[model samples]
Target: MAPAARRTRPSPGPGAVGTGPAGEPVHPAEPVPFAARVVGWVLAVGGGIGALAAFVLTVEKINLIADPGYRPTCSINPILSCGSVMTTPQAEVFGFPNPLLGIAGFSVVTTIGVLVLAGARLPRWVWLGLQAGATFGVVFVHWLVYQSLYRIGALCPYCMVVWVVMIAIFWYVTLHNLHHRHLPVPGAAGRGVDALVRLHTVGLTVWFLVIVGLIGEAFWFYWRTLL
Candidate 1:
């Protein structure tokens, strides 16, 4: 009689690679797409512009404090007056100039963008931190938009640049997170999120259009005269 043969364990499949060290199901690392690289560059440039604007506004705000009759360079017309907007109480939501927040926040954004552009892959926790920061920034920008349009009755050109860059940062970061499954969603939910991100430009376009409409409508009386 022949001796009984011993059986070896089968090799793990792709699905098995999804498991964590604790044998828990996890999302595997996905390849970074080319669009992400483009967004990274955008973030770097946009963040730089935003930071510069913030720095200028901060200095201008300080100058305004020293000279009550000072005029900011960005105060071009009645409708667009950084001096008027900066003098308002809304300019300092936290007992300090809001641009201070932009200065610090945008600096971090620019640094991360530079790293990404250099082909650096951020860890999951860092991506989560970025998502949180971007979320706060977008919300804060919208609040400022409302304050500028309805309450302050003036627009700051530099501030508007910050708004545009902030939106871009938030949108692209959110899309990156979704596409990479950084958020703790189920497999099916992740697929749905991926589908939504696939048409991200559509949603982003509509979002920009909506904000633009809001701005135009908020100053409809002035806009109608230009027509």
Candidate 2:
């Protein structure tokens, strides 16, 4: 009798997402979409900008402490005054300068972004951890925004930059988790979630516009005077 012929499996394509033979049932392989890569690069650049702003603020804080008469370079005008904001108790919410937190948090964000861009697939747990961190960051930033608007009564230019980057980080991270199934949301909601993710830029734009409106309203007197 003739020997039985062996069956050779076809090679998977670059975007193939399965372990078994092409037709057999198998869980999807890691999702490495273009959106993911774009988000990663954005995170890296935004985080770096945030870190630089934070570092500058920290250095200015030190200089102020060393010489009470020193004014921060960012203290350009009444509406944009880091000196005034830094002196407020809110700036040291944990008895330490708030910029310290920014430096540490943004450094991690930037590192993660770099890793993602390098095509490293992080585990689900790591993605969850990132979600948590991003959540905390967004919450903290909102609180600081409230303080700056209604309590401290001054805005820091660098701090605003941090706010912008933080919003971007949080927005993208949330979308990534949802699209990649890292979030615990029900599978039934996947379609809706995907729709939201697709319109992410629109959502982000509205979010930012709302904040800008709030800022303008909060400092109406300054804006009115300028106009």
Number of the predicted model whose TM-score against the real structure is largest: 2
Q: List the residue pairs that clash in candidate 2.
A: none
Per-residue accuracy of model 1 over 54-158 as CA lDDT, tens digit each: 999999999999999999999998888999899998999999999999999999999999999998888999889999999999999999999999999999999
lDDT of 2 at 208: 99
- For 100-131, candidate 2 gives per-residue lDDT tens digits of 99999899989999998998888998888988
lDDT value, residue 30 of candidate 2: 67
Regions of candidate 2 where Cα sits further than 4 Å from its true position = 1-34
* CA displacement after TM-score superposition, residue 147 of candidate 1 (Å): 0.7
| RMSD to the hidden true structure, all candidates | 7.2, 5.2
Query: Can you give the lDDT of residue 220 in candidate 2?
Result: 96
User: lDDT: which candidate is best?
Assistant: 2
- Every candidate's lDDT: 0.88, 0.89
User: Model 1 misses residue 39 by how many Å?
Assistant: 2.9
